[model samples]
Target: MSHLLIPALFFLVILVGAFIQPAAARKPYASIPVKNLFSYIEILPPGSRVLLAWDYDPATQGEMQLLAQPILRHLQRKRVQIVNVSLRPFGPNVAADAQTMKQWPMSAQAAAPTEFGFIPGESAALRALTHSPVIASNQPRTSARTSGLRPTDTLAAFDLVIEFSASFANSQEWVEQVASRTQKPFIVAASGAVAPLLRPYQQTHQIRVLLSGYPDALAYESLLQHNGPAHRQRTAQTLALGLLLILVLIAATRSLLRR
Candidate 1:
């Protein structure tokens, strides 16, 4: 039947394309956004405190994991104190995976970023951040290992805030509450679908750096001169899309011949 045949054929094409690596001849263009991000990240002095908000769950891990990996590595390389907080339940796990995969803290003495765990109330929690920095998971800050994350410290103390979000609502919360109050610089690694939605804020310069989807991730990887999972995913995606178009043309031609 045509129904079964079409899906089977499409699956076959994608299977073949996944194994076929895309050509590397195409020059990867690093965009102004990525460059701006690099500049912002580079300007931070060593030991600067950063608030990293993970607002997406595991559902978007495939897209976000690669994007966040390089940035985390770069931050670790700079020796900044990273404080991770999450609105989504699964986000902390993803952040842990990213740190482990990237092998951050190159030195044994360097401690991993403090994980504040998940905060339940989205808008309310963000509002609390303005009033009280330690909203959820108020662990003791006694250890020098906390990298100066004292219980008394407010969110304003952080040098910068970077949010990796998959949802428009999550990004909006950051824009409205976090950005409005602190007046601190913000960087976002957003899912492609949500990137356009956040552009208006970027236009006004509320968002300092915005990176969307696999292409931007690949571009960042290229800028880092480190070929990683994003490169592999891009190759597979390109090859599969190319093959899919060819399949469509062939199907159309065959239908015309039968007619």
Candidate 2:
């Protein structure tokens, strides 16, 4: 039974940690990338149009939604007009579900996001968006929300471009097809699995800000003065890691005593 004790305790710790909620107010770790992202959004003038690309699917929705919630709130507070578009087929549904889950509060003066639906053809579609925003969108051109967008106006029409990316290639396509050509401030909130691959673009200044993983997400919430889902998950992760470290030390001490 002694041999099985540590493994049992470890699993117990994980089980407990998974349900841990945010307790005390922990200061979020300082992160430049997250801060830069906040600043980019902070500077946008009211009534400025922003192109928000939801590029992730249900597979990555868990992490992606946490990242998007705070961003959507910040944009609302800034009172920018958001135009949502997606590359993946399921992207629009995911975006809608996230909004529904939060029931995101909006001021009367703040306009809700105008959905442009899914744009197919990936890189080709993105390239087309650079030439004409309305032409690339799935939304009807006759709709009141998009009617204001003139044919001559391209990606440059939006003051900022933000993408919640699950795949590095999707973000890369945006950089090459749109950001480079339009010279707009582009930000990407990518999944941790793919964030490292997207860092080079940030380093090269092609991406204005790159936020990924729990750390950046928590840091961003800190910047916004909001304690969100990331905070709770991060707390749980810390607890599990701490418990594992204690168990390891205990096991090592017991072995030394016997020897």
Which numbered prediction scores highest in lDDT against the true structure?
2
Tens-place lDDT per residue, model 2, 1-259, is 4566677567756655554434444677858877877888899899889888999999899989889888887888898888888998998998898667655455456876788889999999999999998888877876525425776778778888999999888898999998789777899999988889988898999998888877777777778887777776776777787677666657655765565
> lDDT score of model 1?
0.78
Show the lowest summed lDDT stretch of 10 residues, model 1. Answer: 135-144
* Clashing residue pairs for model 1: none
Worst 10 residues of 2 by lDDT: 16-25
Give the alpha-carbon lDDT of every model.
Answer: 0.78, 0.81
Q: What are the clash counts of all predictions, listed in order?
A: 0, 0
| Global Cα RMSD, each model | 6.9, 6.0
Clashing pairs in 2: none
lDDT, residue 192, model 1: 87
lDDT of each residue in 1-259, candidate 1, tens digit only: 4455566567766665554544465547889998877777778888888889998888888788878987876677677888888888887898887777875336343446877777778888888876766644544544324766555667777888999999999999888988878767889999988999999999988887899987778787777776767877767777787777677757754765565
